[model samples]
Target chain A: MPAHSFRLLSLGIGIVKLLRSSDWLIVPGVLLLAFFFVAPTVEIALSSIFDEGLTGKHFERFATKGAYVEVFRRTLVRSVWIGILCVLIGYPIAYFIVHRSLRTQVFLMLLILVPLWTSILIRTYAWMVVLGREGIVNNALIWLGLIDKPLRMMFTTGAVYVAMIQILLPIAVIACYSAMTEIDRTLPRAAKVLGASPWKAFRHVFLPLSLEGALTSFVIVFMLSMGFFITPALVGGRKDAMLANVIAHNVEQLNWGFASALALLLLVATIIVIVVVRLLANRFVGVRSVGMAP
Target chain B: MSRKMGNPGSILLTAYTVAAIVFLFFPILIVIPMSFSGERFLGFPPKTLGLRWYMNYFSDANWIELTLRSLRVGLGSSILASVLGTLTALALARSQIPFKKAITALFAAPVVVPTVIIALGVFIFAVRSRINDSELTLIAAHATIALPFVVMIVGAAARQVDPTYEKAARVLGAGPVKAFYYTTFRALMPAVISAAIFSFFVSFDELIIALFVMSENHTLPIRIWSDLRFELDPTIAAISTLLIVFTTAAMIVADRLRRRSARKPDA
Candidate 1:
């Protein structure tokens, strides 16, 4: 009996200790995050701005050089285009899945998800093989007597677009589909019952409700597109270069200072774009949930 | 049905679906026939059926070594990430950990950031530390990349797990550790396993960081990348086909387990 009482006392002490030490649990987690994330970000920022002494030479180089400025401009434009393209292509598919029966929706979702499970590099490589000069499209075109010479499909801006949009479309679809599923089906049905045309009901009810998800998806795809490297490098020409490719090249060349500057610039660009997307989404949709990217 | 909307929407949707499927699957599908080509170089309509490239990949010592090295790094990183990630998940889920949002965000940051950036950071850090780009260092880098996913998925699962079981065990005179081991850990087994499998695949398929970190020793993707850069070989196609088959098998197994758990009654 005495031993059992002692055990009970110890258990009581343990419970008190657990409650008292709740904050300790976060220490390791915080340390890990700080070491991996905060430290590296600080390092990059420092390396970019300072070279032996404090100087903005790296930023100056980006400003003075027309090539860097052009690359930045093109990267932004290309990413936005790709994001818009994904939304356009993905919305119908997302709508189809959301409107279908549960079983049918699951099947379609699986189809979309299976390809996403594979590596993006593998997917991009597949495109390179398909879009090459002697690839399937070229061979088919020749056989159909469409062109006298093989078309230059690979290593072009168009090729980059095709690959990036294909990779990012699934994300948009999934995002919009999840959001669409949340909206009450009866709301749209009520519009139909109130003498509204199907198209008009969809535009006024469904579109407005789903806009937030669509916008969030757009922001995510845009940010991801900005950071694209392997796809563009493998399939894009020199002119199709994004900021990510430039950062990668600098890293390879052992120019860490320049690489950090490029990386920090990319980060800043992404943050600004995300902020703009959120503000626009909030004003247009009047819903905060739709502004957040998954 | 409204003819005004139905016809055009259906046509557009069907056309887009077909085009998207063709865009997504054509490259993956074309590799199969090309893998069997008798010709030395890659061609769309492979001249003849032959097992030469498949034979070449199997016999090539360099390719075999790289494949084995990749397997080692992948397996090591997967195991490491899963253990640490799952532990961190438990702390986040069960404990009253402060700054929950910040912690979770940090864990998932690797997914958001471009991998090339991470590679550069690790490369710079490694260079300064004088750490050689060996298999161990590469595995560490890969583990860091995969850790966040394991934490996120496992934590989500853990949040749904019942606390009553552990509480009951503890009330029945079991120690905290013993109660957790008997009740909570068993309940979390399926999620932990699933998270481990996903982390494994993330490590296995990673290429960019491996490329940045390793030069003398190459992973499977690195090998294929280098081969593509030097020359377009049928052997690379064969290797890709093999990877597709293996990945599909692993995915099926994971999916089956998920389904089985979904069908099982709560414990």
Candidate 2:
């Protein structure tokens, strides 16, 4: 046979082999994931368990230490609160963008995305500048004669809330906006045709469809908040430390075992929350609508 | 009907949205003048206007070094991530892969999980492997962070590509490799480029892991953190303004490119 024919034969064989294989394409991807992601997580988990023969000291420390418990609780509370705040703050913006004319939606979308273009560090710095005692808000208030003295804002839980909500609100808005867009306008109109009031129509026909996207948005914000370190570290008071901050502290202090344990626990807790949130949202809000992209 | 008179909820919703936008964006907009301020402090409403701080950042050796280091890490990680991610996406999407959902979830987990936890895991593994916080280690870690995003974007792009062309080419006696390169690869280029641009931004904007992992070999964010920790400086404001311009331009261009390519009938 000619070389060309031989090449053709080999190509056909390769194709046959490829078709016969279960997941040849995923081999590279799976290997990469195993190496880069799954392996590291496994290592962290294994290290936490086996400092030397599978001791439970790391987990015990977390359970026994008041500091760890406080940090964990504070982290959960702060993250949940921030997630809620973002949802509360983001829902209206999402509603506006969804209901607006097409041209207006484009412009507002840019406004929403422009902040995301800037680095999170720069944005956080801007917050520091704005909320600092000698910063813009104080100066503006003083100039306007609102108070005799500057209000203490920086390094407070308020600062953390403000900065975090700012940082994560865009995500919530985008998520909710996309969700809201999926809702059929006719559903509300149908309710109106049935003698329901406009607001009642929206409340019954529209809100339920959007709830999944809103809940998913809330979960995303909460997940991201669980990992937040810089914003809280920079803005929050010393007592406002989150799990990420504590993990960073351990990593910095060379306590690898302890840090790994804390990280694993955080991961497990995040997974549980995500699952629980999904279940709850599905039960109440009807999660099938989430698949409908706005 | 008196419904319009009675229902003030729409008005309230509009007000809340405006307040939310202001709260989210007011600080970002306020920094423009702060960067231009000729004051010794970072106080709002500059006492005077001058380009001294911009000049200071441009001339400062430390800032220059940090910028270069970030560029090296960002660009390196971006290339590594885009290449590997595109390839993996192709393999996963186009290949006859069983457990496709599971594979996709594995790729996506890194993005969903807290970066702080990933950073800790990477930190421990690096320590064990004796890979200190050198530039190379940082790049590898960043590539890991960026990989998932690249996979997602590129995979979506790949789904839009017509597999019939590759099949046709193969029928025309083209080898599988040759057919893929000639037919499928060209179609995937726009997505590849967009994913590369996004991967670069991901590495460039990333800070959490950089903070925990690269303590000594400081990236720009770490430098800014340390500077802020010590004292107030207007130089950071100046640097941030420059970054904002670069990022905005890049995103706009990428968006345009995406739109142009998507509008292509052949695509």
Cα TM-score per model: 0.90, 0.90
| Model 2 root mean square deviation, Cα atoms | 5.4
Candidate 1, superposed: residue stretches over 4 Å from native: A1-31, A287-294, B1-15, B255-267
RMSD of each: 5.6, 5.4
Which residue runs of candidate 2 sit more than 4 Å off their true CA positions? A1-16, A19-28, A286-294, B1-12, B169-182, B258-267
Question: What TM-score does each model's chain B reach against the true chain B?
Answer: 0.89, 0.88
Which candidate number maximizes TM-score? 2
lDDT values for all models: 0.79, 0.82
Q: What's the residue-level lDDT of B44 in candidate 1?
A: 86
Candidate 1 structure, TM-score to reference: 0.90
Q: What tens digits encode model 1's per-residue C-alpha lDDT throughout A175-271?
A: 8888898898888889999998879899888988888888888888998888887788888887888888888788778878988888888888887
